[model samples]
Each structure stands twice: as structure tokens, then as C-alpha cells.
Target: MARPLLSAHAERRTSVDYPYSETMYASVHHERRAAFGAELYGALGIGSGDHTARAVYDAESLRFYGAPHAAFLFVQGDGEARLAADVGAYMQTLLLAMTAYGVDSCPQGLLSFYADTVRAELGVTGGRLLVGISFGYADASSPVNQVKTERAPLESTTAFHDQGPSSESVRP
Candidate 1:
């Protein structure tokens, strides 16, 4: 299905104006998703530190009212790019799966800039950078929930190759 987006700035306000205090928002949930993320990393063979961001969930508004619930830091390395892609894709899938259980999430790609600080905080070695995913139930009322990000069309992104003996094409 196509993603949803907001039409204008005015439209954004009505989406996130929840009537609860921040403390009240966090208090409604018993799920420790950050801990789950850590455990998930350990089980999947990816090393993770103890860093976690806050996540907000509001059942009435159907919105997660806070910041990220966890952070994962990695150093610069030969496989960093591929590993990041793999990790991002895996996490996206995991979020979608959570939706089946009545949880919603948006991956906060913009928050990956705190690598140096996160590294210092976590005492990570090897001059690696930071990567993180903000996961939580969807805030139906948040303007973010209304904003839609675009994906490439298959025809626009796909490439075809000719093998001479037979024609071959690759899709990515």
C-alpha cells in the first residue's frame, strides 16, 4: 500500500496534540522495547550496547509521543555500508511485524548523527560511528504519522542486461 503524508503545516498540528503529559504518555505502557531490541541484537549475532531512547505510545491517539527507544553504534569498517543496509531492512521488517500485534513504528533515520558522542558515552573503540532505530507504536495523531516518504518505482530503478545467448535482467 502507498504511504500517507501531510498536506501542509496547519494539518500537522491536529495530528499530535495529545491531551496527556509526557509522563502520563510513558506511563501507559509496560513494554520495555529497548530491552527487547538489545535481546534481539544479541540473538541475531549483532553486538549492542546499553543505550536506549524513550518511546511513547498512546492508545487513544494511536500515536507514539516520544523519541527513539534504542540506539546501536558501529564503527567505520569495510562492511559498514552493507551491514547498515542489512540492519535497516531487517529492522523495518521487524517493525511491520510488530504492527500485526497492534504496534506501530517509524524508523528515525535522521537521529544517526550522534555517533561520536554515542561512542564516547558507550566507550566503544575503533572510531566507529552510530546507527539507531526509533521504534514504538504508531501515533495515529502525530503529524509524522501523516507524512509519507516515497519509494522508487520498479520500472524506474530496475536494469536489464543482455547475455548475448540469452537476455538477463537484475532488479534491486
Candidate 2:
């Protein structure tokens, strides 16, 4: 039932404006709950009965103020070493996907600590906790989002060798 419901929600990615009000939040929460309710750990294969381990879990246990729009628990299966880099790459993919849908996201790595709780909850072994992603529509009015930081000039940021074998042939 939950799987079907989540699938339905994921399928409904048409033009819809989800305001930052409680009502819209409730709707998103319901879909999230439908997709990841009590059976969350179980669905991910680390329930109470089973002894299977995981690398990620819920953020609610952290006891923060406002709830995230949605949380996705990711485990480091097989490729634990490259998890962080892989995650960053995937996040950029998510950003592109969201952009197409008129939505925005802020891929965060700051939650790696809280992900510890997720590991503890899942009783995972070997692999370490990676990070958690908070996905939602960007608040346009947010000054943080609106402010675009500039980068150093390409020459300062990039390193390159002489274009030719002769020192006089290239300009540094």
C-alpha cells in the first residue's frame, strides 16, 4: 500500500505549486509518510526483527525544530569508500532534475554527524554513515539562495602548463 502510494505521489510531478504553509506541508508529509512511514527501516531491509545493517535512517531522532521537506536514507553498500563523492555527484544530478521541474534543492553534507544516529538505529556494521539530503522547493525570498557568490578568476583557480615546449612561445 505504501509503495503504491509513494509511487503515485512520485508520478504526480506535473505543474503544482506547493506553498510553504502547513497545509502544503501536511500534504508533502502525508506522501512521505505513505512512502516512508513506520515501515521505513523495514522497507530498507533493517527492521526490528531482522539483524541486517544500514548506513542511514530518519532525521527526526535528532529532534530538530522544523521538519525537513523529506528525508532519504542512503546506505553505503559495496562502494562505501566512494560514497561521499558519489553522493555529491548524485546531488548535482538531483539539482538538475529539480531544476527541470521548477523545484530547487540544497544538497547538504553538514548532517553527516546526525547520520550517526541513523547508523546506530540501523545497527549497521563496517561501512560508515555518509550524509542526508533535504529536498524541497527553494524559497525565492531567501537571501541566502538569492545571493550568488563569485568565484576567483579562472587563472587563479586553475593550473596549467606552458602551451608550447619553448618558454617564449607561451604567456603566463
TM-score of each: 0.43, 0.42
Write down the RMSD of all candidates, one decimal each: 18.1, 18.1
Candidate 2 residue 89 Cα shift, in angstroms, is 1.8
Question: Which pairs of residues clash in candidate 2, taking residues 3 or more apart in a chain or in different chains?
Answer: none
Query: How does model 2 score by TM-score?
Result: 0.42
lDDT of each: 0.43, 0.46
Off by over 4 Å in 1: 1-65, 73-77, 160-172
**What tens-digit string does per-residue lDDT give for candidate 2 at 1-172?**
1233223334542211111234645564565544443354544456564432432233222222122443433646576447657866876787788778976554434344444344444565545445445556655664334444344477865799866577567566
Look at candidate 1 and give me any clashing residue pairs: 5-148, 15-141, 62-139, 62-140, 63-139, 63-140, 64-139, 75-128, 104-138
Model 1 RMSD, rounded to 1 decimal: 18.1
Question: Which number leads on lDDT?
Answer: 2
